[model samples]
Target: MKDSLEVLPGIELSVIHFHSERFTMHHELFSDVLEVNYCHRGRIGWDMRDGSSVFLGAGDLEIHTMDCCADSTITLPLGGYEGITVLFDMEVLEDHVPELLKDAGLNGRALLKKLCPGQTPLSLPASPEISGIFSCLFEVPQKLLPSYYRIKMLELLLYLEQLKPSHVNRLTSYQSELTVLIREIHDFITADLSKRFTIEELSKKYLINTTTLKKIFKAVYEKPIAAYMKEYRIRQAMLLLSQTDDSMADIAGQVGYVNQGKFTQAFKEQTQMLPTEYRKRCRLRKMEKE
Candidate 1:
């Protein structure tokens, strides 16, 4: 498990990775604040004090209003999971985004209070546009993170303001009801990356209709199962590139790619660079840090 936390004047960002470990968390909030969370990989769930629960899967995003004295128990996945969280102080929003406040006819604190009354959390409508923004946040170079964060903050606010009230309300009411089943499917798929399963086989094994499986899988994982699997393999390859001294062919095979040429092509397509170049850059970065 690895976790990094970065703190700025009015906000905090945490990028967390858990590998095959069951992590339990009990959180009791002492203040009113807004939290934006993006699930990059795997799943997480929160059991609220009110008896309601919210689960976030890979590529799913959600917001929270940590009303004073609110509490929840969090369940983390056992296979692996990665997530990013940003906490915003109400005063920070008030001091930084005056234009947004003016348009909403309230000051920052007032607007924050209105958007989330600290009762129930809201799940914003997900789109390619929103997902792409979240992806970019991770790829930005470390040196540019602070400025990039500020820019993304404003962009997020602008996008939020444009969301229709009715739509936002409806989305808040929508929950991924079959979270347990989806997580089971995810665990199976990720358990062995080298093994590829057919849709029919998966449907039979899971006892779910093929069409329903595909739809819910996409909704939860934010991509088709096949696409997600391919990306998962590529991600495994990426880690090997940075952390191992294996040859390209060996690394490719480890991640289920039998053909080095094909693996190179996919690597370039996903990262826009060759595997050797990526390894070299990683080494250089390590040397610089050392």
Candidate 2:
């Protein structure tokens, strides 16, 4: 779901909630525009023009010109994302700066130069103050959304205006080749849930050094291979619990757990409920819906 509001003549705010593997973006209508994105959950990756890739995980911010993302595929490695985007139409914004922002001495062109001095996109972990401002965007009441968004937009810009270059920590960008290899490794490992592969084993099989393999995998997926698989396994187990009548042992084995005891422990750790309890809860929720 995407909700957009033109908070000002040249400033627009959008809330993006995507639950999909990939989204292709076209920038036909975008030029001389600055796009700022904040990731509230999940991970998003962008294939850059120079055969490199950048990623944004939860609590991260990405700022760049729309052209940087032109004709690019945005990959959601975790199959979901929730975020906010603010677009600044530089020409319009420069001509008609909002009175409030003008009084506060905030200029669109200046902000662009400050935040993105180069052609490459700038991505960094959001500061606590910035995160606080964004968190409030998610909870504004419907009736007050228009006014609230405008206020928050100004606040965000003003806050950013005070930041120094040294405070910005650019996120690591990986080569497309390495990212592709890591993705292949992910698919290979997740393809057969009944089997498990160690880091050393995967490294040898994929012909990548173990250090690079682990580093790139964590960068792409935002977790080490083992942690990512454990979460993936639990998510699959959730689907099985809700949709199938498989026995505990069968379900456990299906998701790579050797025994029900181990599966129950992992399930509880991930979901705070045993497999049996989780199944029962699903049934109860389904019955209530019915």
Candidate 2 local lDDT, 239-274, one digit each (tens)? 999999999999999999899999999999999878
lDDT at 131, model 1: 80
Poorest stretch of ten by lDDT in candidate 1: 168-177
Flag regions of model 2 displaced more than 4 Å. Answer: 29-31, 103-107
Q: What is the lDDT of residue 260 in candidate 1?
A: 94
Question: What Cα-based lDDT does every candidate model obtain?
Answer: 0.68, 0.85
Winner by TM-score:
2
List residue ranges in candidate 1 displaced over 4 A.
1-122, 126-169, 172-177
Per-candidate Cα RMSD to the true structure, in Å, reads: 7.4, 1.9
